[model samples]
Target chain A: MRFSVLILGNSSATPMYERHPTSQVVNHNEQLYLIDCGEGTQMQLTRYGIKSNRINHIFISHLHGDHYLGLVGLISSMHLMGRKTDLHLYGPAPLEEILALNFKYSETELRYNLIFHPTNPTETAVLFESKLLRVESFPLRHRIACTGFRFQEGERPAKLDIDKVAKLQIPPALINGIKWGLDFTDKDGKVHPSSELTTPAPLPRSYAYCSDTVRIPDYLPSIHRANLLYHESTFLHEMKDRAVETFHTTSFEAGEIAKEAEVGHLLLGHYSARYKTKELTLLLDEARSAFPHTDLSVEGKWYEVE
Target chain B: MRFSVLILGNSSATPMYERHPTSQVVNHNEQLYLIDCGEGTQMQLTRYGIKSNRINHIFISHLHGDHYLGLVGLISSMHLMGRKTDLHLYGPAPLEEILALNFKYSETELRYNLIFHPTNPTETAVLFESKLLRVESFPLRHRIACTGFRFQEGERPAKLDIDKVAKLQIPPALINGIKWGLDFTDKDGKVHPSSELTTPAPLPRSYAYCSDTVRIPDYLPSIHRANLLYHESTFLHEMKDRAVETFHTTSFEAGEIAKEAEVGHLLLGHYSARYKTKELTLLLDEARSAFPHTDLSVEGKWYEVE
Candidate 1:
């Protein structure tokens, strides 16, 4: 199974220099899911050669302009381009009214069915589910109602050992049981342990996204053991006071969260516009000091979840 | 006095390679006025090296997202940059509500005074006026309620004839009257003709912007004899039927309007996304076939009204 996250924008509220606001595309086995579409996101997607048509689902974390200002423009462009597939949108309840207002004023009749799945930021619960993956939302500490999403890969069935199954002369009726790790019996009344007939299943991978939030203890468990974790690092240690006042996290605090959660790798982003591009390395280094496996989330960069 | 127009975005609806949606800046005597802010207009202003702080007035033509979607993001950035100047916004009544909704959801209280001036699409009247310039709004045929703007220069002062005034011994109190073309009384108790005391005033220049509209005769008088005219040319001659259906103008129709209004020059823009940059020249040539002084409106180009 292929799972990767492509960073479209990583800057904070204001897009500075070549950096853009918060936006990303999560490619889960070729099914694209968009996370936090900021302004200029459609252009960024075009710059990165990502087709907007592949984005079947969109998840918004909050009502902040930096996170969701680009939604209406992207949706309008999609309708103009003659999109017909039903799009599933998950965000706060106000998002539906916001989108409806735009359409009402523009007199745009959408060519596709837009399905809105309103997400609650006050509680932790599963938001969406499929055969391979399940998405859950948890509360985040911010000035406004906000949410962090966690993608958990579903448990996989054991891989059948084809050669062992043939040699043991397994009946067709027991093939499903063998793949499910159940012991099988042959016509001669011979017992075959599931370990002899099948190989162990691979470890399922998971990813979590937390942004525009302060360091809070409640979010630690939801993002624990994620194969990859993306957390907002809006400031460094020097600006820790400013970060706290803005309901954002410092690089050190982000690293501490990553460490406490024991994630496979940490991706730090949502940098403040006050810092220059060259200064971003300081954030990455500070995060790495606490959690060694940390990297800066750069626009157009892709990180795979192992 | 200085008057110039800077093209920011010229695409009709969809933003394509190297072309953006409808947006332009009118610089009048060092003061910047924004017109029709579409998505990515802020970036376009940055690309053209225009400071956002200098824009104190913004005019949106209609409720179409391609016309005003970039407004909120630009406003937010200005606020973040510590802008305290009052912004005078002139557009349809719905525009104020759209901006208010964005700020409400984002929980952003402005740092500057935002004044809204509502425009009626059914009537032609002056929107704003100063001693040297006046801006008026007129109706345009569109799928929805739309307005076209006309920038009319006020009467110019006559050039002073210092030698004639000295030789005639004209009173200092009559200098203002002399520039305003009033006959002056000489110190010798003789009356000197106004023509001998001062040179005739130069012709006042004017410009008109008609976009997202079909060819209509009602808008002719408001734009008559404009020094420069920018009209929407969303399609080529072959797509006349489609243009009529979509409430857009083809290059030939745009040229015809310019020719009928006796404008000094014609600017054609709002190109369809179907045409590449290489093919834009064909639209210019077709418009020139009807009106010889037609030019294509490319982004970042400045056209002076002389």
Candidate 2:
């Protein structure tokens, strides 16, 4: 039941002050999903000890260089490393053309199956679904077509009570079924309810990633009440006009969005190259002015989804 | 009069053991020329305190992802940073199509001009020439179309013998012409030979870059008697057969090439991922066995072309 987000790169537009461009990884029950892979992402993945080959799904928010520049290199590395598992990539439709042209020029036929899924940047839609997780993409207002993602965990099965199971002499094969809410029958033909053998599962957690977007109210409901929300705070309140002009979010605006959506906790990232290390606190302070429970996204750290 | 190379990355195929893919910077008289911009090259430039905007010319060796994947990102950064001067890029013909497609997808009309010059990988030809330097491209034996570059310094003007000129009371305006081997006719009607007022110019220096290639004699004459040579050594002698199959050069083979060309010094790079830090000494040892004036190309270190 491990759910966490790892920040690989957190800077905006360009890499400055030891911070790389925008990229991160989300882990749900050991399955890794990469989000917004910027330049130096592969090196960052190696630096953070994340095995990139384990990543099966990648979601690109936009086609901006800072958001998706490292994609081709990552794909090539995966191919050279002899990956055979099919990789599912979700991004803007033109990204498929970019990848095809790159591979065509390089004369490379990827050893693994690359399945591309075109994400409609104009609407909200469910991008992926599994037994344990569901990922949805929602539109974001930007200079180019962009989208944000919300990863919500589905209802988890009840945990098996090992002590109760041992005392009841439950067979090993039936234990897995019992964890899935199956009723067990005793050897003497006495029926046991599933509720008696298991503990209630925890509430499903959700994490949302919003980047390279202006402050807009249209998609507030899509990320409402998420366990953890990562919002782009490209500038401070002092640069609010610049934020509006560039279709980016100010620190205060990001905080306001988190507060309006009523998220559990707010994670701010995608900082402009203008801010130095000590000045980063000003951004956090400004965001906290609007939303009290807010923290800055630090690269190479794993933030639990809670 | 500085002629040196800074290795940004020195790995082959994939980045491993903290080594990124192949990329380097050649600095001649303060002018920067980028070669083989692999992934993370811009970041590497930043880390090494090299202002990438100063690079006016870029030479890509091949279409391999490790060789040229960072070109688009670097170009985009230059555009965003408000570059106005033209950028000269030399590579295969298809590279133009790649750049056009990338820009079309990003919806970016670059602020600066990107002047493209296609290199012929089959024949030797002078690609660029300035008053001080001449760059020539030659064929390389690789799986794909690849070219090696030779940066040769043009004939330098003679240096003024300042003490002799001062003793003779030469006028300031005439001093410049004396350095270029012009004779001075003194007001006293005395003739001063240009040789008497200036010291002989040193020999012109040249550096050759050969990478991603198998051992072949076709390009040996093009690099003969170079001041310095940077050659790819993707594998050790133990993997000689593997190197041959992959159209790559082993460490011993690279050393042999340097020996046959009679280069001033040999720089061995593009190491395979199989070698660890301690094992890298073995590569150096193997190259040194054939050519004694050989050293491994260390990233971030500047190697002067003497």
Candidate 3:
């Protein structure tokens, strides 16, 4: 299975000439999940050739314009394209009301079903579950009620050791049982352990997205051991005071969080427009000093995780 | 007075690779007014060097995502920039509710007062008045309750022919009276007719913005005599069936309306993404067949009214 993330936008608060606001697309297998669609997200999707109609689920972190302004436009475009598949939207309580009012005034009846699942941003709980992945939301310390998400792949069955099974003359039915972590018995009633015939599968991969938050150490437990982690770094270490005042995190602070969480890799984005493109390298260097796997999130770039 | 219109975005529903959605900035003297901000409008404003703080009023024609999606982001950016001026917003009733919900959830204490003026899309009435301009909304036939705005500049005082006034030995006070279209009377009580001394001031310049609407003949009376008119031409004449079904107008239809209204200049925009830049000239030609003064609206291009 292919698990990756495509960065669509990364600028914070205000959009500048070279950077855009917050938006990212998470690709798992053949499905795409959109997260925090800011203004011009649809344009980014078009530029990247991502079929927006294939995106069945969207997760909005909060009501901030930079986090969700593009949602209405994205939804409207889907309707205009004659989409008929039901779409699931998860966000704060008031988001649905806002969308409903807009549709009411425009007299727009979407051909697709827009199922809204309002989440409580103050608590940690499971937000979505499917056969391939399970998503959970954890609280974040911000000016508003904000939450971060953790996506982990479902458990996989054990793999059969073909050489060992063949040498042992394991039947096809017994091979299936061994893959399920069950022991096989011989005709003479001799017990054969499943571990002897099969090998354990690799650990399920996971990713965590944390944005628009200050230092929230409490979330480490839920986000720890992620294969890939994306966090907002709105400022550099020199502007830590401003970052705290604005409920954002500095690059150094984001690196510290990734190090403490022991995530495999850290991708920092949501840069303040004040910094030029060259300054991003300096910020990434500061982050990498603490978390060696740190990298800057660039728009239109994709990061793949096994 | 300098009267000009800056095209910020001209694409239809979905913003394409080379075209952006609907947005325009009208500059009258030193004041600026924003009309129909689509997604990514803030970035467009930055690209064109439009100071966001200078826009004190915003008018939205409808609740379509392409028409008003940038409003919340613009408002948020204003707050981020520490603006203290009040902003007047005129739009459909549901917009107020959406803005309120966003503000409520974001926990944003706006630095400026957002004065929302709810507009009834079904009625044609004066929506706002300022020292320099009077704005009125006229009904338009669309898929929803949409309206177009007519911006009429307040009448200017007549300019005195300085050479003529000086040659006639008119007093300063008498010159002011003549500028106000009053007859000048000499000390001997001899009456002077106003027409003999001064010509009528140029008719008040006006601009009308009709976006995402069908060619409704009834609107000609409300928009007649406008110095400049911007109308949506979402398709070509061959797509008339699609235009009517979607409540949009073609280039030919847009020109027909402008010709019927006798507008000075017709600006055609809101192009369908199906056409490329090379096709724009052909579309303009089609429009000019009916209205000789028709022009295509291009992004970052400004049109000045004499």
Candidate number achieving the greatest TM-score relative to the actual structure? 2
Tens digit per residue, CA lDDT, model 3, B162-255: 7777767788867766877898776688877766677777778999999979887878888898999999999999999999999999999888
Could you give the C-alpha RMSD of every candidate to the true structure, in order shown? 3.4, 1.3, 4.3
Q: lDDT score, residue B245, model 3?
A: 95
* Model 1 TM-score (2 dp): 0.91
Q: Cα lDDT for residue A96, model 1?
A: 93
Stretches of candidate 1 off by over 4 Å are A157-199, B159-199
**Better candidate by TM-score, 2 or 3:** 2
lDDT of 3 at A158: 81
On DockQ, the stronger of 1 and 2 is 2
lDDT of 3 at B289: 93
Instruction: Give the runs in model 3 whose Cα sits over 4 Å from its true position.
Output: A156-200, B157-203
Q: Per-prediction DockQ scores?
A: 0.56, 0.71, 0.64
Select the stronger candidate by lDDT from 1 and 2: 2
lDDT of 3: 0.88
TM-score of each: 0.91, 0.98, 0.87
Predicted complex 2: DockQ: 0.71
Cα distance off (Å), candidate 3, residue B243: 2.6
Show model 2 residue runs off by greater than 4 Å: none
lDDT of 1 at A29: 81
